[model samples]
Target chain A: MEAEAARPDRRAERAAARRRRDRRGFAIAAASTVLVIGGLTALILTSSGWPAVRETFFNATVFKESFPDVAKAFWLDIRVFLIVEVAVLALGLLVALIRTSRAAAMFPLRLLAILYADIFRGIPTILLVYLIGFGIPALANSDAEGSSTLSWLPTEPVVLGAIALTLSYGAYVSEVYRAGLRSVHPGQRDAALAIGLTERQAMRHVVIPQAVRNVGPPLLNDFISLQKDVALIAIIGVTGEAFQVAQIMASTDFNYTPLLCAAVLYMAVTIPLARMLDRWDRGRVR
Target chain B: MSGTPVIAIEGVTKAFGDRGVLRGIDLEIAEHEAVAVIGASGSGKSTLLRCVDLLIEIDDGDILLDGEVITDPAADPVAVRRRLGFVFQAYNLFPHLNVIDNVTLGITRAHGLGREDAREAARATLARFGLEGREEESPSNLSGGQQQRVAIARAFATRPRAMLLDEVTSALDPELVGEVLRAVRDLKQEGVTMLIATHEMGFAREVADKVGFLHEGRLVEVGPPEQVLEDPRDPETQRFLRRLLEAGRA
Candidate 1:
């Protein structure tokens, strides 16, 4: 009975079993991944059309020629994505707060917030980019001197495109924020109010901080989509971005390898971002 | 206990949809006195507390805090709440905040105390509740009893006019309930006016100046704890006590 306290666990056998279990888990994961992903990769690589597909999609000379320019242009995508993401975050939070506010004075603003979310979220992102990019300039040029719209209304495709991206994503991100705000138990908000915090104070300091914490995963998930959607700008004739440059290179040589190069560049940012989000999520759970 | 009432609930009627929760309930707590409301789970105990805090609106009737009709539609709920502290059963300390922040938030933000002064006051209150050096630890790190104590401290730190304890010890493990009850007893000894909703009949008998029993959304009985717990006139009150005693909870 005295020694039972000292030797509470079968430590040696348990440790060995734990190690064996971990190794078995890892082996199964690796085997299943190899069987599924690797099998698909190998099947495609060995197909009868593999030679032609390789020539068009995986030409090393084409990659070497296109990657440097595409990589350089990818910088534009990174910069715009960062700016748009931050802008969307701020705007989305504002809309969410406005929508969630209960003040009678904020009634009209609340309606506007709802309408803004609905309109922006309803339109396709590419269509929005096209409309804003082409429509604004077209309206401006139609002016007698093109002065007012030229002066204030952005004719630049990139600027217009960025604005469209911000609006479109802001709507979606605001809904995410709203869901986060709602996900927080009503008791927390009640507790905040019980302590004498005003409605605004409760939301800003207590509710918003907690809500933002709740939505971190979904927020990051949206940003990932936004990062890829930055390529939508290229469709509106924005030059010096990855996809457009890749498209130009591919057209010149009729080799699709440049497109693959662009895909790799997009993954370079997205994969690391996804990984960071995952790491943060894990750290939070621990 | 003084003659002046810190909180007075009069003819407070509340209904959710068509089902009534509090049907013309009336109770009062004098300054430095504790009144415990004991009843089964759906007996409107929490609803009474929430109505007094102005957390939920009553369809009819009024509540008075320090002789002012707070349930008047014109009254500011936030200002009314500012003077009273309501502790929830679940110990709703802000998970994102450390223990000290949970206490200091109301003091600094709502009470408008200076940050340093709030911290000093909060430290003293936390220490009084047996949580002195654990100020900066997150609420999640504390055990159930400790967390409830922090919730109590967070409410008490602001020096509220009246403290509302909503089954403060109900959420804790049976073994951990004593420490939280001890904290409430300390408040009672400190002469803090309190309106407590609780399941622990023993705690009520020990700390409360009076105990009220609720049955079917009605205040069926109210008197000194000894009178209410030992000999009750209402059938509902007697039946409730008999059930508790049968379950060995009394």
Candidate 2:
């Protein structure tokens, strides 16, 4: 007779052992994390400059005092960022389309687009900002001969800074868009055309939609960089943005806490976006 | 057989640089006839189909759709393609569009069917291909067989004069291949004229009214399925069939 009720099941016993092993693993991981992190904390706390560093860089008073002004200036940053982002997206797609088109009439424009992407993307973004912020106004206002050319150009540092950012980011984003366009299999174009869509309609409806989807993660990545690099405008003396305002407050009292406040503000927007990008990537991959 | 051929190719030639792909090929598909071109991987079967659809411009000669020469400089390729249905080997369904949109794009945009009518037409076509209730799903979310079925539905929705199938079953899994081929067989039941470039010898024997053997950019043999597959007169055709038998595909 098989007295199964009296016997211990092998599967049950194995599952119990697995549960024990998992618990032990988790405990070990927790212990190691505590030991390493606590050791580092103790060492940093014992450093000789800890007291002074805490007062200037991590002071609660300065952060509170500068938070309002930094937040106010961040609005300007937000406005510039939104405007520049829209301009960059449009400009990038235009350049990529011109470069990819086969029209003989587009030859000159295609050459100009190629050079624009190459030159703008090659230079550091801050250098472009500095040159445009100062050079354009100087050239437009007068010459050594006192004969001005293109005098209608805006002299505002903010406008010039926005333009510089758009040009630089547009170059990088255009390359991203071009790669997306090329990544589509040639068979796709054939199938689209075979369905009776005109070449223009094919690009607009079938080709571009898929191309944009293929490069979404990289495109968002470029926008994130564009967000953080908004601070570079401060180098051209656009002092209304958060980073510049924070720097001014920090310099007045020799307290670095206002800079920390600005960093936090930037992170507030960028970190959520970065997390969303990660999730979007996971969805696409799955 | 009594009227103009649905598609006629006369002395068609195409080349990519010094390498010629389709060299002086002539073929015809009469109304309601299914013509299967059997060939090795790069024997210009696909090139032939693409040339007929005007996806790839011919280097010489002319192709006629319903007795109208389409290769003339004045002929509009877009309008010509709108009158033909071409299915690719890779099932090139637009991944961004759902099944319904993929089917309706041609009907609405090219045929000028109203959106509501186009969608109803797409639904009916998809249902015929056993793809009903899959209208909202992305092509990427589907199996390879289901995707190819959707592609066929998309092409058939516009009700073109002839269907060009370039190895539609070649990219499918072995088990899934039967479903897509069954869909094609159903199209035959509707009396749709077809030109298929395929490697399935059994399918060619079952469905094609005539079989053409292509070898290195030329049609080496053309006859009834029995004469070509069973008793090919050309030595090249015999050798090709023997190779297939050795590989257990025949």
Candidate 3:
């Protein structure tokens, strides 16, 4: 009789535990569902005018007319992105190396990197673009008579856009690389030292490879952000490939159709890359 | 003992954040001596070994390795560390590199061995530690015993004058402990001057030439393994031995 009585109490405790777990799981599921629904509603309301959206997005004539100019602009964007990203990656790595190194000389470089990251991350990218595009050019024009070097270097929209993006993203990516460096286990460094590798050799052979692998997803995400950010270059009125096409179509029809079309083009490029990143992240998690 | 002492620590003091871990540790390890440091956790055995290798900077003492004062502020720590190998309580195998790469990394970089030669040397060392044909396997994929062996192989591959084993077998399963100990015993037979911090009294009794007991950051006792283990003169040493024996028996 005592055993029977205790059995029911034990069963009750187990049921309560199960109920608690179920409640927690349900809460998580409900929260995720609400978030998804909210996002979907926002997307639907923003894109509610289907006919206008369709005309802007799927109109074959508009796409065909803009194709050549859009292709050129797209290529230009790619060039800017590639150059900026490569430069940022190289500089960020160098800064990360300096940040991690014990050498007293690297202390100044480390501080500079920290300051750069703080300043660039704090400022608006638009402000940086304006500063480089308009402010620098205006300042240079004033001094053009005295400084041939300053005058000779083109402050064209493309050049300014590239420089702005590079500086801004370079600062951000340096932090990413720094995080990657920090993620490397101190034990691994000690192990390398024990086996007779110098600090630099240990970093190059053991630490950096692991750090790069660890930061792969974040690095990819940064690349995608940079890709979309190329649109910011449109503000300068340089009218390269994408902008020229958008301007011609918008002017012809006096509609925002061309801008929407360009947005879709961007989605087309970035969506696939984003999906690849998602898959890579999932693989890493598993 | 034909050559000079492989490692000599005199008046070595190490502290972490105002807490002195090694308070003026003075010891000499002859060439090819296998000295075991047995102590409770945080008793400064590990710190003493690290100081000898110049991994941890000494606060106020000098460490002479191969007749050179490694603890000298002017000495290059990297150069000093190149002559000694260390294994940690948690095997610090490079997870990114497979066993072969982990072992060959130092040899290739520090000694300037060509890739083929380094790989060859690494292969031989790995084979000795029963890691043959496992060169391509990542340390993460290997079992704990295998990983520890790979770490040991990595250290031994460098051909250092001395090896410091900081509780190498502590993290292994009881069944797995033998394989690592066997590897250490093999290293001992090869005349590697070793300072091993271990909790395994049986292994220390069986294999160590000398055993030292550390208590509260002090080397409280040092003598032959039988004398230290069986006939401890210090009360703290006896109590520690008793507890360890009881735990092992349990």
Candidate 4:
């Protein structure tokens, strides 16, 4: 009788095993959810400042009233981010290709690229914004006695901010591209050359394609970061973007709801991108 | 055995920094003949093949193709390599390209064939090598034997003047070795001039018109297969064959 029960009917046995696994998973999830909710309730009840914190940060009416202005300013933030992201990727790739050039004549170009990456990457982003925003215009106006020869240079606050962001972000992204380029196996290059492809053709057809593929996930991380850093433009007094508008609103109303609104908007865009990139990462491994 | 030489390596020498790999090596391949070089690892057999293919720059002397000096500084290595087909021990097929794409890359790029014509030629070549239905599959999906054959097909599709195979079967499973060697045998029967560096002693002896034994960056013995394999004159060649014999490889 015992032997008969043990005799394998494979489908039925597999079904029973799956049911047991599902039940175990459900039990663990239920216990964990209860613990989290219990801990959160205890913390809220025991804290002395909970009411004050709630009144200042989570006022629903303030959230409702501040939503429109914050939402409007967010479009400007999005626009700047889109433009800067494209500029950063293109400039970064150009610098990386030059840095990795194999020709003897490209030594000077390679050195320039190395210096650019090191210098821009060392300085903080806010300092770069301040310097580019105030320094360039100030230099153009420094010669007060004569006609400013550099009048043709851009003095707009938004343009200067975009330039600052691009320069800073470009340096970091170029390193990412360089790492990807180096990760390609030397054997791939050898095979390409052995088949009569010129060095340029080999890089164009074989090396760059593999390099770009390898760097896709890390590129997304840089992109999400660039999206967040768009807020730093508020420092340069670009009053059209969300963070600047939120700062003004908070100072006038003495409520932080506008800042919270801006935070929510940023998370709204970034969380979806992060999740999408996670999916891409999983698919690549499979 | 006597026609205009397809490839001739004249007193070629190469070194990596301080260590000399190929010291004053000379070789010649006549029309429709197979020359095999056999030696232990690191004996410069592969370097000799690489020098002929122009993958490595020779330190001294020159290589000639069809009475033209191809190793001159002015000679375009790209043009010279286009006339030669080379396969490596590891079967370095591009991972991103499918079988047909890999086979057709040289055809389209170097041979200047249009996309449609290159694809047609690639398909016929793949079919000839018993890989007709596998054209669309990535190289990573194939067995080691199949991948090696694809590498051969990629080389043959361009109608190169001569083929250089560097221990093409060294990385394959034992059962897979016969299939690759069979393809080589068919190429020989079809009158392709080939220079092969290999470790398979029995196959080399059976298929090669001439055999050369390399020892320490020099071609120590080179003659007819029977003379070189059956009665090697040099002490290094003798000891090398004796070792292979003791290992049950000869």
Winning model by TM-score? 2
Residue B210, model 1: lDDT of 96
lDDT of 4 by residue, B1-250 (tens): 5677999889998999988989888888898889999999999998899888888889999999987899998889999989999988999998889999999888999889999999999999888889999999999999998999999998888988998999999999999999999888888899898999999999899889989899888999999999999999999999999999999989
Better of 3 and 4 by lDDT: 4
lDDT of 2 by residue, B1-250 (tens): 5888988999998999999999999899999999999989999999999988889889999999999999997888999999999999999998889999999998988889999999999999999999988999989889999999999998888888999999999888899999999999999989999999999999999999999999989998988998999999999899999999999999
> Residue A49's C-alpha lDDT in candidate 2?
92
- TM-score of A-chain in each prediction? 0.87, 0.92, 0.76, 0.91
Residue B88 Cα positional deviation in candidate 4, in Å, after optimal superposition: 1.5
Candidate 3 docking classification: medium
- What DockQ was computed for model 2? 0.84
Q: What DockQ does candidate 4 have relative to the true complex?
A: 0.72
RMSD of 2: 2.4
Docking verdict class for candidate 1: medium
Greater-DockQ candidate between 2 and 3: 2
What lDDT is reached at residue A99 by model 1?
95
Q: Which pairs of residues collide in model 2?
A: none
Q: What DockQ, between 0 and 1, does each candidate earn?
A: 0.75, 0.84, 0.73, 0.72
Instruction: Quote the lDDT for A140 in model 4.
Output: 70
Residue range A153-235, candidate 2, lDDT tens digits: 99889999999999999999999999999998888888889899999989998989989998999999988899999999998
Q: Please, what are the lDDT tens digits per residue for candidate 1 over residues A58-88?
A: 9999899888999999999999999999999
> Candidate 4 lDDT, tens digit per residue, A71-101?
9999999999999999999999999999999
Candidate 3 segments whose C-alpha is farther than 4 A from its true place: A1-60, A142-149, B1-3
Q: Write the per-residue lDDT of candidate 3 for residues A1-286, one digit (tens) a residue.
A: 8877666577778999999999999999999999999999778768869667667566777767766667667777777778988987887787777777788877887788778888988888888987787876775573535764456656788888888888888878878888999998898888877777788788888899989889988988888998888777778766774755677778888665666667777787889989999999999989
The better candidate by DockQ, 1 or 2, is: 2
